[model samples]
Target chain A: MKNTIETSDRPVTITIPEPEYPLHTLSVLVNNKPGVLARIAQVFSRRGYNIESLVVSPAAEMDFSRMTIGARGEESGLDQIKAQCNKLIDVISCYDHTDDAVVSKELALVKISVGASSRGEALQIAEHFGCKTLDLAPESLVFMVTGDSGKLDAMVGMMQKFGIVELVRTGKVVMTRGNGLT
Target chain B: MNAEPRDGAQTLLKCLEAGGIEVMFGYSGGAALPIFDALETAGTKIKFVLARHEQGATHMADGYARATGKPACVLVTSGPGAGNTITGIMTAHMDSVPMVIISGQQVTWMLGKDAFQEADIFGITMPIVKHSYLVKDAADIPRVTKEAIYLATSGRPGPVLIDMPKNISQGPCDAPLDAEIDLPGYNPEKAYEIDSKDVEAVAAALAKSERPLILAGHGAMLAHAGPELKELAETARIPVCNTLLGKGIFDETHELALGMLGMHGTAYANKAVCEADLIFNIGSRFDDRIIGQPDKFGKNATIIHVDIDPSEMGKMIQPDLKIVGDAKVVLAELNKHIKALPTESWLATLDGYKKRFPLSYKIQGGLKMQHVLDVWDRLTESNSIVATDVGQHQMWSAQFNKSKAPWNWISSGGAGTMGFGFPAAIGAQLGRPDDVVIAVVGDGGFQMTLCELATAVLQKLPLKILVLNNHFLGMVRQWQELFFDNRTSGVDLEGNPDFVKLAEAYGAKGFQIKRPADIEKVLTRALEYTDGPCLINCEVVKEDNVFPMIPAGAALEDMITEKPKHRMEKPTGST
Candidate 1:
């Protein structure tokens, strides 16, 4: 089948650079039922949009669940994915909060192997970044931090200077301040 | 409600009756035995057509949906039976046909445990189904059934699945039969609400453009927008062309009709599309074959697209003006607002193209596929439902078998699945028992699902089957000749069965046409047979290549209207 046409004739018309497309955040509200999350996740991957991070929790009511997903892809694809997800019988609504006037927060637990002298500096950095000291082992300290994704990235960057042992983070839960329902 | 405790299977039947499914196709198995048993004592309004294969049953359901414009039903067991329906389900999904597939599942406890005859069918068919449900409790059966039927038939209709577990079906439940559909997120009917502003804008665009044309698709046919389409074309004086699925949307004999447009479409239609100043795409997704060069296609025209599906808008050629609504409502509104536009000279130009480069072929050497279709269409009077298999014969039928009615042209577009024609034709015949139904299959594709002949013959379906025996997979062979230096590999049908004998073996009459003179005699005799299924094995010329081809990805202007002079030599001892 490939030999049927010249190379120039193929319909490879559009080539947009991937780096130009930034990460897009979406808040999807769906029915709190079995396999709803999997269906929502499959819609994104089917359209080639990978979910960087996803947060699922009960919504304003118990019957529905709010899924805050960090999705990255081209803008058009994100728009299409939002429409596709909305078409699902389980999904009530989906909004890309990447550009919305809203507030978001994520919780991360970072454990770093610190020496006895550097422990004080690490504690100082954690306190400056609004981190809570969750635990302290003989040679390591676990810091619980909460902030927006950007702030958490900056905090993680600062902590990376130390010998970071392990890390776990929740999805970025978001809410509009005034009246917008995501 | 009966108030007496009806079992889960009986509850499902009552829900199906509520949803207005008159008939269904299926094959019974262990997981499906409960439903089958319930049908024996109940289901007074439902009729079941037993198929030899699950895949055949699915295609049969698909054909019923395509022909009747109503949602059709299919029932199959779990595991292999459920797995076999993926192709047919995907076929309906791609073409946007309305269908509901019921696959009997393993007991609730055995699910996901790799139990006997268990497959994660709900997971396997997620991408293909418009919506799916795994019945956990027997109480949810009524809701799932109502929702599945409603979803399958609404808006951009497609297949919906219900994975009914064996335990769920056999268990007793006290659920109400009139379970109100509780879908908060699903609102398919809203797409049918048309805004007058869009109609005005389209009318204004039509009034301004000097050269405008209409490109129809299967969506238009599904929407039953034929009368409105004809009204709009006549009112706006726009020349109309169609996709393969859009065959009978407009009467082919009408002056405004430019047959079909795209790859293997008529040369005049392709040229008209490339040369038009404004192109109104109604109910048609701009498939790749239609738009030859994405960059070059419609570069000169203001493309206007109206469809029910919003995802289709930006997936291909982005129209300058996009309207999301049902085709009938949109076209009807446009017809109400618009008067005739000045396309006199433009029509004359298209007329010139049609006269100069018509859909033509030479049948001098031997009996050709084109001539076979020509005679069939003439004898059938172009009013019957014509289902075609994939390959050279399919394209030739698209070019020659012009349709005269709506929902009469059934083929597996987009998926282009072979072996779809025979079963689909049987389904169409059953759906429209009075209307003439025919399946023009190739030798390569007919053998794919010939086992379904038993299903058709046992029920006494009056199907006219035309087996175009070209002795090779002619489409790939043509490609190999043109592009692969004529090194045809796995295309020969050396072990092909005698189709006449095979049809007779299945208790159907069979005939043969070996020469040009035998075409009419055999077709007429075959068409006159009303006993049951009939077949005609016409041995056609083996090397004929369909013309007016826009080589994959080539610009529409670069279409090859006729065979090139330098061609590979014909294989010896052929034709």
Candidate 2:
């Protein structure tokens, strides 16, 4: 075997990944007011930015609101918007998570067509994705899955190959990875 | 009563007076002649403002209602006279203004025989009015009159109608004068409460989530929850987005402001909304315009919906936590329970997006409409009220005009009415005399109610008219270019008369602007003139269109950013 091996052989190659656009998760603190949202929306509207998943509620200890905004944009523009928001009397603060650590997850409910023939495969897939069968009919099955948006989307794509009837998704909900409350 | 004096017409006038109606705008007609004659002879307390047109009369009454927050009454005769008030009635309905329109009908004997100058006025106005009543007997007159006023001024105010037969106005019985009418299932002061369990669930979710988005709608405006919404967003470090109807609810100048979200939303705002991790909807019904496709919307986030209307919750998109309550109350309680969260990274990301795709419009190397808006912005005070007719100009004003306070911007939102601004401006101006009033109308829209100039002159109202004359119905032309393959339909006004002459005819001064240089000076002159009403028609290029347009039914991201390449295709002869 050694005598038959070639002298020169190609090395198994592993390419280094290129630098990517920074992903950021932001928590926007604002006043719950009419037109306040419009004003905030105008900032994104005029600029043509895309928001990922957003969650809003009032803070635990104040008379203000909390908005969790996920988005991908250049660093400078995001900074300008944050600064602008901070200048508003109603805006308490804005936190960007691109440079900070955060935890985020998304939830989805999918209704898929599962005939008797595909029932076993559908159940198997649902079990693998940690999804619960919320509604199980003779002809169809509805599964509820909670996870990151990407994970849910992947599961949905896998299920789509069989047959999808309808789907409902809750956008992403996020939190900081650390214990910093402010 | 001395011998129980019984004149049918006089009795009707007395009933109207008893109903607490101080004034009425109307025109005389055949079937209504007796009522008018009785009004003249009885010397009733009610004053009358005779209108040249029935439409004008209705609008005057509408103006009175919007001004006083009371149901203003209008009187019209049978047949076409009653029909003429339809446009004004529709206007009031669309804007949710309160008005009571009374129409005289043929005598009770000839009610349904298709008599001359007779019409099924009640049936015709049914869809347009909140309620319509047909007076069959003289005994029902007093009760109907009071009920009509009450219904018109009640919850979510709108127009109400009372059709008076000629004989009913004359025939008499014991006056049905009482302040009470039992209306079942009409709860004007209904209050909604949030479920405690749902509030706790939402609080827990907020405590855990890092990135959140708040979407506010017109319901917040109606609820007067702007302050609470602002407080919640700020304290929680959440970004906010708004729908078109909710434009002024949040201050646009806020840093966390994502601008308007929907088909016509700014690119940044749409992107932010689409990419948000959690979407909390407040006082908004997630209209299709706001959400492009439910499957594609908030694809990566949990949606928390809070609304006063339970039916609205989870109707469009299911929420992780559905809190049914008034926005103000829910926001207040949520604020008390949620701790402050860090959103520096989120703010930084939004800021970057804001800079990369700023809201920009082109000038076309000529007189820019921005200049006109800028001039108005400078001259008008914060208290100065502004109304706009539906078109590119209205959007432009919405985009440019900085309203520092509430109720300063009044326009037909859902209806997108073209001829609304002229009459509405008159009404708003009349309502708030001390506040400066300006109506920004397009040339096409202005001509629709150009007759109202006479009303302004007659009333001696110092209303200012800023007509952005592009010689076309700008919005329709834009649509034609975008959707109709550039076939400019009936949208141009090339052969129209000089507006200055028209204004002079109505005893008002008019200023015309064609060149870019004249805008500021003309606006200054128009604003300075404290005399009678003045019109400043800025003759902009005929083909210019508003940019950053969201095509109908498209996602907010698919906005038209620059000027369209098509240029009128040589003005298809005689529009």
Candidate 3:
């Protein structure tokens, strides 16, 4: 099995082994001031941790921004990152969302070319996976999908049989479920 | 509500008066000229303590804050002045000293356009300060000043920067100067509330423990929790071992007082920590120097940590239980439920360790550093506030000079900044005018900020400076001799300036002591010279090293007390 970018479609095959470096998702609240994001990023860069994925948006508060960061590192390294992040002045709070105590989602838009022969199969796959038809052209169709990052990846793989054209993905956003961490 | 309009400088002076800032340490520059003029003209009653360098001013503010437990304001000009304050701010940040630093910036119109003497001080000090504000409006002075003082002096106290633009200080405003603070995101007091459950848990642990030890840190001093801590220790009959910054927080002369515990700590203190059945770490971060090997530190103990900052918990060693609150509040609460427990047998065992491994040095040498410190300690008695620079002399001072009162021992413990002693001593003297303030610095560290001598002379501060002239960076030289095959690289000060002559040039009385016989006489004279600052240059054996040192990453039990070549047989202890 190969894990590579899906090119030329044909249901690109992929396999992922057990991760030695576990994935950690962290939700950080920070002041919505200039240079804060760069400061937060530098903290990770200085500590030698690569951010796997990041999504930042204004939080419920007027002057605060919430950032969701997904990174892969050893458990101890991840803990160190959390501790260092907490030390930053702009950072109001940093909560680790790796546990199942939170709800998370990632959005992806996949544009795939659908010939008449594969049109039926493509529509059937989209319908089965609950992917929304964002735009439908005679030859190519764009479907917007929202789910956990893994589920979105699976959807992208299944849609690859129709000859994928262009794909864009928004990382992930997370929040604790049911009146948890405020 | 109709207050007269005033310029930015007058407004800032008014705010300073409102904040109850009696004195501020600073050096004036172009950007700060308006504020200085206002200070002179407005008669706001905020006395200015001038410093030779901006760095010296910052250290003065830091020492003042550390000594008084109040926020000391620092005023400096743009780029160079702000840049010079980095070391002082970092030192304050590391030790949680309360300071408010006001750096003058280029006018708001000239910002980001490469104006002369302009600096992005707010951005530069973001990591070093607890908080910072870039004030563009003169009307914001009262509010910003109030916030800065509050943040600097509140829970987990640290330095805060306020970048006041030149235009802001020159502008006029009629805004009512109300010192009301309204920071929604900043809440330092919530998490630090005393929890009854944690107190009960701590009380229960103390009751069951056979050998419980209390490890105190800087927070205890910052919180003024010494009396409460002493009460708790006496009630529970727990022996207290202090981190370097926590030295004066407990009475060092007390029988239960195990001296400082760290790399250069006393052997008995570290041994007690290692052998304790339960450890109560109060307000200490468990710095790497203190806990050389985290896993091996207190291997037999169930550690319980109490601190104001929640982030510090489980940072070095995972404690069996943790509590987040100010040391004073938490200790006061815990003491209410604590009854005097029987710790006689356990304390007796530690007493044996203390008696067996007392911190000692060879007295036959020519002007040994220890003897100088012993003489200084005897001459000064317990009434003196001793501030030391980072090096062998610092450890020696900590070992020899017994601090009898809280906030009496000041040193750059967390950042370990060299050259912090002289300026800090000046600040301490200014802060506590009635007390004797002595700075015991190594020759190497003394040279780092020796220019502050002029500031001391000019201010007519009665600061006593003792330069332990070892002619080398003794700590580094010792480490080189032990670990680096005796390869002395940059540690030697070959042709250092004559500190006595140098002090004389700075308008200070200079005293030189070479023979061990003259240590007392010179120290006495220097102490007697209350007219202005005095510098005592004591020439001593150059190769002397601090002892009971836990080699980096080595367990506290593995201390090197003597020269490696002629070391005594190792004593076996429980690991």
Candidate 4:
């Protein structure tokens, strides 16, 4: 409903700019039940918040599950989403780890296409990056790497120089530092 | 000997009985045959109201909930029946009315196979409902039933859903009579600890402020805080203005009442709001329509917002001091320590505004919607339950009719659903059988759910339906004429059916009034007819528009008053 008035009677108003959005990781503790993960996904999709990366696993207790989700949205919009999620019965709690000091890890499996000459250098680089060798074929060397998201990115960047043939990375999983609960 | 296994339908009834749902509005279907069969044989004390359409059933349930401060249950079949109630569900959700909606689903094994009459109702209504569940087992019936009622009626009440698969309902289970729902995260009574310091701060603000006004909203009504609100307002000597949904919370006939404030609000109320020094917004979200320009809104005042929803605190208009608590509790606590203020000149100034800029409309040729409402209010003694459809008529009803009781004025405040008035009036009539229930609708909106006319006719409800027939979608036409360079779009309702004949065809009495001379007499006669539902086709001036409008983004003070073409003498004995 536009309120613009003509005939030199009303003053024109300025329209505000769109809000700023940033990527955030939230660790949500929820009841471990059927379709609980789907419910959380539905909540995010309903609010138009796309999940960049997600990892779900059983929490410290067997009856509950913890999900680490990376998403991007305006601060106010995210705040509203959090409030709405907080209202759900199965959701025990949700915490944003982006602003907190938390330990996080991701796993990546890479198969590097290696010539007989480059095999030695690839193994050296993998060892330097703390990667474990899963298999060694005639033309390719498979390595398993586990670290934080940034470390995985750097490891993949190093492997890109050796003509990486294939790669797959699990999304980040996180735990709060100290005695804080997520 | 072992006890015989009770079917799912019987268990469903037992759970509903446990929830204390005395009445339900629904239309049976193939998926819900088991439920109907159980009701037929069991002879449960619960009364079932057979509505013509599922949408009508939902609205009726919404009306029942709003009028009685209790959650009303609704039942519908799968797919279309469930989908039809979305508008009504959204309407109730937006307005914060408590309701429990039960829809039948396909057999449990056939859920994802896209079997006959399956539409994934639980998934479809996810965003709209307060909470929803797809009942997987019959053993969870009692627990789900209790949780549904609890979630729907507690803390900032809203609608909840339970999608029951036919197999679950027809299967056998022996659930406990009192099922304990273990919900660690679902605490409905999330009370806010109101600080004594904050109350003192508010009292201090009010004590020194020269032009303080109280903006009471629907939350006050929901909280049953009318008495406390009146006590607070009178104790502080602050003038009160209601939001559209907040109607009847403060007695409209009271001296301090400034009617309603917002778009198409009374000129005086908007003026008072614009000029006030301390604006206390109780239980209002300060929606866009209310605050024309957020930056400029309440510019002269320190806005103090008291509401239960913390999300609503700083959402729109930022409050200098926010009290997060129920309306009644907060008002009661404030009243304990508040001292009366001396604002004689402020009240006098508001009175002056009210007298100078009274809600006015000049009559042209045919009858006016405002006049019809004025007459209806007068004849009904301003005490009837009034439900209004959206558009020019809704605004006119809100402006002209003075609601004398709480929850008496029910309308689609946030969603503005068109066909809401008729079924809502029927629900209100059933809720308050002794009171006169009237549905004020425009011709454009009246035709939306007029099929419910059969429900009213067959049930023999004593409802008064007033159709303000203007032969056009008057509100959109007015906007087109003013804002869209006077180029009217698809707003003309040329081949509209004869509403009087339509009502008669549905076995209800119908009256037609086309002139000013017949307006009052015909309306009084229609109101006096108490046999069954009556429809009054009021062919009013086709171009009449609601005035005192705060143009979309303009400040409250920039209200545009009507410039009628010709002025006629004021009618004698008019309200």
lDDT for each of the candidates?
Answer: 0.87, 0.72, 0.85, 0.84
lDDT of 3 by residue, B509-532 (tens): 999999988988888888889999
At residue B418, candidate 2 shows an lDDT of 68
DockQ score for candidate 3: 0.32
**Lowest summed-lDDT stretch of 10 residues in model 3 chain B?**
B566-575
TM-scores for chain A over all candidates: 0.86, 0.76, 0.88, 0.83
Lowest summed lDDT across 10 adjacent residues in model 4 chain B is found at B566-575
Error of 4 at B239 (Å): 1.6
lDDT of residue B217 for candidate 1: 92
Candidate 4 CAPRI grade: acceptable
DockQ leader: 1
Flag the better candidate by lDDT, 3 or 4. Answer: 3
Q: Candidate 4: give the clashing pairs.
A: B8-B169
Tell me the spans in candidate 4 whose CA falls farther than 4 Å from its real position. A1-21, A33-48, B1-4, B563-575
Query: Clashing pairs in model 3?
Result: none
Pitting candidate 3 against candidate 4, the one with the higher TM-score is: 4
Winning candidate number (lDDT): 1
lDDT score, residue B481, model 3?
Answer: 78
* CAPRI-style class, candidate 3: acceptable
- Select the stronger candidate by lDDT from 2 and 3: 3
For all candidates, state DockQ relative to the true structure. 0.52, 0.01, 0.32, 0.37
